[model samples]
Target: MSDKINWEYIKEFNDSIRTIWMPFGLPEIIDPSHSRFSNGVDIQPAWKIPPKIAISTTITGAMFSSRGNPNHPMTLEEISKSAREACEAGSPIVHIHVRDENGYNVLDPEKFHKVIDPLKRDFPDTVFDGCMCALDSAEWPHMESFLKEGLLEVTPINTVAVLYGDTLFAKPPYSMIEKTKICQDCGVKPQIAIYTDADVDNADRFLIKPGLLQKPYHWIILAAVPGCSPMQNPRQMVEGLMRTYNNIMDIDDTASVMVCAAGRASSYLATFAMLMGLHIRVGMEDTVWKWPHKDDKIVNNAEHFKLFKTMAGMLGREVMTPDEYRRMIGLPVRKK
Candidate 1:
């Protein structure tokens, strides 16, 4: 054997990568005659996104309209419009959370219509993902609550889960697989989210026969929750995610991973996640400040995305556009 390693194959593989931008593949605006839905609908540049960064608008300007918007409140039409504008800025997967009439936290499906309706109307081309978090109990009895009171009534264009520690099952914990079934039944892909390694393990553990859990999940690592995960150890953050994703892949090769942000990890872990060939998720819900070091400074979701895009460029990586993301994730072509 030659002293040179298998370098030829590596070079060929590198050369095989086809990199190009797929602009919405539609015409531009001039004297506007149609209101988007007219003339077979064309996807515009504004409603497009770089594939690498799937901006999670949940915590940013979602649910609530503005930073100063009152608690126990619902998002205003202007705020939803702003969120859609942010989507236009470049959010491949727009993560949405609907505010309840209570105004403190997200509500069940009662207001799901009210929230998703405007977003669908505005960002018809962008992929919108909704949340289905069971904040109360997780007993067999509570399953119905999550369905009847939580995510049953509404049919999201897409569904997401935020299963957290100490929120549902404890002592070895259980899975809310029922939620995913409901979502699949509703014809929406589940945007499954996890915080810790075990949470991901739970997802990995329950792929096929889910008695109480969801399997075959589209995973997102929401790094460092307010009280659950600490933001100090970036290395630990990477190691834990590496272990979890690698472990899941080892068992089931089909699991797709998304690296999400919460607070300071939102600022720092962007590169590490990119290094792992994963996507980023940042928004107001995950973090309120622009960067970890900045003192109480606020940045909007789109701006945060631009920040991450700059990081990717500095590191010599290409951020995927909306069309690329849809193709990569096996999602359908977004209609204009």
Candidate 2:
């Protein structure tokens, strides 16, 4: 043993650290043909984001109770109407979570079909996605049935359980695997919902290695879910964004990632992501508030979407049409 520690070993180890931009292979350079870049004013090159941010309209969801807001859409008619408004407002994809007549969350395939079928038929161009949040094995069949019928084009798959205080969401690794397989078999793409950094690590280690998760992986980062890492504060939101960005950057460049928040942070973080040239999701599902600190109440998903549209406009970013979004995310382009 040496009397003094070897400083040369530490130097070599520190110098070996490097960052990889594209891990698997180089992804096609995404061009911002549809985006409106800042032209008149000189802007920093690093400040430029992709011109078009693909937005998802989450029709009816609240961080708290189903009846959290008086204007929460419960009936299929109201849900469909909200979705239509969002589509018209520039949402290429709409994410829905069906509820009962009393505004309670339920996973009934018939209810899902009733709402999704009509909107898909009417919109024709919009893609419909959903939350397959089956907490127990018994609930899996119902969700699986929805996928089998081709009612959903994309569905969310998370490696870990989402928690609210002491309550655990109960998404075992096996369940995630089963869900991923079902999506693959049914031709429904998985959205790989990630709530924390560990989830991303799991994707890199287990999910991708077995080919359980596919390329062009769509990710939804749940930044401010209660009992999850809190992102209600602006500084915390930035930190969360950096952490997510670093983790995903380490995973794959081709992966499509989006940011969303529950309650008050919803619009703020979403707007930030939009300005950063990343995808964003907004609706009553994440929050019932129209602005930060719950300054105003949101009437419906369309209202939430319109506000986001204003933000995108101010930032000089164009919202992608359904077809443009489809092409960007590796989905089939629908005939216009």
Among the numbered candidates, top lDDT falls to 2
Tens-place lDDT digits, model 2, residues 1-336 = 675988777678786648766433224343333213434543333554787777788887523444567777777778777877887776778998877777667787778888877788778888888888885677779988988988888888876655754567646777778888898889888887777777787766667878777778788887676765578688988887878877887778767888774556778888778766788888877776766765677776776777787788888887888778767666778766
List TM-score per model, in order. Answer: 0.64, 0.81
Candidate 2 wrong stretches, greater than 4 Å: 1-48
The true-structure Cα RMSD of candidate 1 reads 14.9
**Backbone clash numbers for all candidates listed:** 12, 2
At residue 165, candidate 1 shows an lDDT of 33
lDDT of residue 330 for candidate 2: 67
Worst 10 residues of 2 by lDDT: 26-35
Each model's Cα RMSD: 14.9, 12.7
Candidate with the greatest TM-score versus the true structure:
2
